[model samples]
Every structure is written in C-alpha cells, then in structure tokens.
Target: MAKYANGHLPARDRFAHWRELLSGTHAPMTLSSERADDFLARQHVVALGEVTVWPAVFPPVTFRRTRELIRRSDPESYHLTLMLRGSGIADWRHRTLRTSPGTFHTSDSSRPVEIRSWAERGRIMMIGVEVPKAVLPLPRRLADRAVGLPVPDDQGVGALLSHTLRRLVRDLPEYRLADGPRLGEVVAGLTATVLGQVTDGESALPPHVHRETTALRVRAFVEQHLGDPDLSPALIAAAHHISTSYLHRVFRAEDVTVGTLIRQRRLRRARAELADPRWDGVPIQTIAARWCFTGAQFSRSFRTAYDMTPGEYRGLRGGDGPGV
Candidate 1:
C-alpha cells in the first residue's frame, strides 16, 4: 500500500505536490484550483493483481481531460469512482451527470472528460478502482453504458461492491502477495455484476457467477441489517429480489441455515460487546438488547453458544473474539 498527502507545507507548494500526486496515482490530467490555499488531500492505494483499490480525500478543484490530454497521455484504463462525500458533475461521453455520496461513476481515460468540484462543493472522499482495459472481462457495450453513468451503491450488487472495496482498502496492508489472485476474483466478480445490472445485461452473467456473487450480497445485507429484529430469511430474500426457497438453496452450500447464521452473528456481536472494555460498565441487558436478545433468553443463548453466561464471559475474557 502507498500513502500520500501534503501537510505542514507552504500553500504555494501544496497545489504543486497535489498535482504531482494525482498524476502519479492516476493518468495525467489538467488540474486547477482557484483557492489560494488549494486543498488538502490524502490518498491511500493498494494494488491487488490487475485491480488497484484507492481511497482518497480532497477539497474542491476542477479537473479536465481535454481531447489533447487524452490523446497524449491516456492510460487505457477505467476508474470506477465511488463518492464518499460531497458531489460533482462529470461530462463524459457526451453526458453531464451529477454524483452524490453513496453513488459512483466510471471514468474512461481514453475519452475526453471534464469534472468540476467547485469552491462550494465542500470536502470529498471517494474510493476508485483502476482496472486495465485489456483485462476487464466485461463486454464492451455493457461497459460503455456504465461510463460516466451514476450507479447507485445503496443496494444490490452496487452495495456489495461498495462494501468490498471499502473493506479491501481498510485491510489491504494485512494481505499477502499470494492473496492477490483471490482479491482479483472478488474485484472482477463484483464489478461484473454491478456493470451487468446497471446496463440491463444481468442475464449475460453466468449462473454460478450471479448466484455466488449474489450470495455475498445477501451476506452483506445481513450484516448491515443485523440490528433489526425483523430481519428474516423472507425479508433477506426479498431485499435481493430472490425467493425464500432460492435463498435457502444457496445458503445450503454454506452448511448453515439463514436463521442459524443470523443467530450466530447476533451472538458473536453480543459476545464482542460483552468482552469489550469500553462496554464494561454497560448493563448486560443493554448489550443483549443491542443484538436483539433479551432477559433470560439472552443469557440462555449466551450460555448455550459460549458455555458461559454473559456476565461470566465478560468477567473472564474482556474484549476479544471466538476463543472466548
């Protein structure tokens, strides 16, 4: 992983360093800022096989990929920019689109484009992937449709991709070189599904890919909604637009039922809290309620799952995982 930022530097040199950093991370582009102080930004990037996962923060600036610039320095890559903060407008492939937090858009380096983050645009945070054009297995037509198009990251494949990318960025430093291939599979699978769905070509994805990838999405949804007591197999299936039977069929491959998975997850979270020093003074009932458990029911499940009561567990292990 690589990290870059300008701090404790003269205002005049900040913009210069920012430009150099941007060009080094991405393809060279025309960058400018009207603010005398420019903007403080930081970038953290990791290369996982052919995919590059980058998370960054920046202030308002205007960036343009003019025809001349593209012709002279195109990288022949596509960047899927997931907006984490603020908003901006991108003019690419004859389209002007507005993007906000929790949404993403693709930037094709081969094409001329203009993106503006105005003075009033506020701070920005985003995660983007750099995938070489030649290595992207997605169909050209489908890929083109997603270029410069705003893709929703709040649900479905988009949500899965969003979560996976953020997690990868957070955990990148801990990964080994041999894990690159596995990471590549994750990036490709989620990227393909998101693109296919956005372009109305979801049928083009093979059955195994769609099923396995959607299974991950199901898991993501479960983790995200675990706090809701109403979370159930039927609701989970509905959220992903699959039937309850289909949900069970796929989950069977994991050797666990939906109810079992939910229970285990809730129990695990409750256990974490019980062991956490920060929650040391918190009532056992409150911790149970946080994970949708209650009273004796919570204690019984806690004992059954861990062979000890919540109070005993907290007294014993204090903040840790599984082994407790």
Candidate 2:
C-alpha cells in the first residue's frame, strides 16, 4: 500500500503537488478546487495485480478528462467510484447523474468525462477501483452501459460489491504484498459479476466467474455464522439454496472443503484472541467455545495447526499472567 498526503506541503504548493501526484497515479486529468489555496487531502492506494484500489479524502473539486488528454494517452481502464461520505455529479456520454453515499459511479478512461464532488459539511471521501477494460468479463457493449449510471448499492449484488470494496480498503494494512494477485482476482471477479448484473447481461460471464462469485458469497456467509456450532456444509448449502454436493464442488476451486475452511477460520479467530494481551483474563476454554470449539477439540486442533497446545501458546504470549 502507498499513502500520499498534501498536508506537508506549503499552502500555495499543495494543490500543484496534488495535481502532479494524481496525474502520476491515476489517469491524466485537469483538477480545479475552490479550496486549492490550501488543499487538504490524503490518499491510500493498494495495487492488486493489474487493478488498483484507492481510497481518498479531499475537499470540493472538479475533475475533467478532456479529448486532448485521451488523444495523448489512455489507460484503457474503467474507474469505479464508491462514495463513502459525500455526494457527487458525474457527466459522461452526454449523461449526467447525482451520486450519494452508498452509491456507485463509473467512468471509462477511453472517453472524456467530468465529475464534480462536494460535501455538506466535511471533505468528500470515496474509494476508487481502476480495472483494466480488457479484463472485464462482459462484452464491450454491455460494459459500456454501466458508465455514468447511478448504481444503488443498498441491495443485491451491488451491496455485496460495495461491502467488499469497503472492507478491502479498511483492512488493507493486514494484507501482505504477496497476496495482491489473488486478492485482485477476487475483486475482479466480484466487479465483473456486479457489472454484468447491472447491465442485465449476467449470462455473458464465463462459468468460472460465476463459480468464484458464488464461492465468495458462501465464504461471506460462513464468516457471519462462524460462532454457530451447527454450521456445516449442509447448513451452508441450504442457506444459499444449493445442494451440499454442489457446495463442495464450488469450494473445489478453492482447493479446500467447506468444513475445513470453516474449521480453519474458527481456529484462526481463537488463536488471535489467545495471543492478545487483552484476552489474558479470558479462559482458554471460553475463548475456544466462543469460536464454536469444544474444550478438548479446540486443544487438539490448535496443537495440530500451530504445533503447540493452546495453554502453552497462551502462556508464551503472556495470556497466562494471573487471572487464570
């Protein structure tokens, strides 16, 4: 991840520095801000393979990509913007629309477009994903339909995509650079699914993308129900209205069975708590049970996975201080 802030620069030079930084990171564009005299903004960017996720906060501004700029160079990518704390207006293909928090707006780098953003109180904040056009799993005509359209993110697949992007931005520091390609693949898959659904062209996506999308949804369900002792392959499949055998097939692409994934995630959660100094007062059995593991089962599994008994591991981490 890379972070950039203009606060360190002199007030007079801040906006210019931001412009240069924007040109280097994103597509070339002309930026004009009423607060340019002392612009305050910061951005964090994470590169996932060919895609980049950038979350930024800045004051009111207008961004324009002109025909002249496109003539000079084009990244041939689609920029998807998710408004987190503000509202904006986007103009593209002779269409203009307003976007608010929990909504999405897209733009194509191959064309000229203008976007003006502002907030009622503080600065505008948003997450933007730059995906290569050629990598999109939809036909060009269908993908084009999504540009400049206001996509409501409060329901259905749009909501899932919105949550995924937001979570990625929020928990980005927890991920290593080596995880980029795989993470990028997941993001690209979800993005394709959302775009296809928005354009009423879901049938256009390849079979693998659909499988991956279903797997992603299933994993999210598992995460939400991790503490349920009854959680199993049958229950998970039933929740999604799919058969257990089919669920297994879906996870075949992940090279792990559904049950194993659940167990791994549960153990990981328990282990994290066991190692935390704040959890020192919590009993090992209680922590294990909190993650849906029986006392004996938790000890066995933790030793198998981490090569140490839970008590020993907790003691090593100072979790065995005084509180028992």
Q: Which candidate is the best by TM-score?
A: 2
| Alpha-carbon local distance difference test for all models | 0.80, 0.86
Off by over 4 Å in 1: 8-11, 36-39, 119-122, 170-181, 227-235, 252-257, 276-309, 317-324
Candidate 2: misplaced stretches above 4 Å? 152-156, 170-176, 277-282, 321-324
Error of 1 at 304 (Å): 6.6
Q: Give the C-alpha lDDT of model 1.
A: 0.80
For 1-324, candidate 2 gives per-residue lDDT tens digits of: 899999988999999988887776679999999999999899988899988889999898999999999899898988888888888888885899898997888888888999898899879988889888888777788888878777778776677788888898878879899999888887877887788888888899988988888888888888889999999999988888889888899899899999999999999998898888888887888888899988899989999999998888888855563322
Candidate 1 on 157-252: residue-level lDDT in tens? Answer: 787888888888777768898998668767876887788888898787667677678678778878889999999999998887889999999888
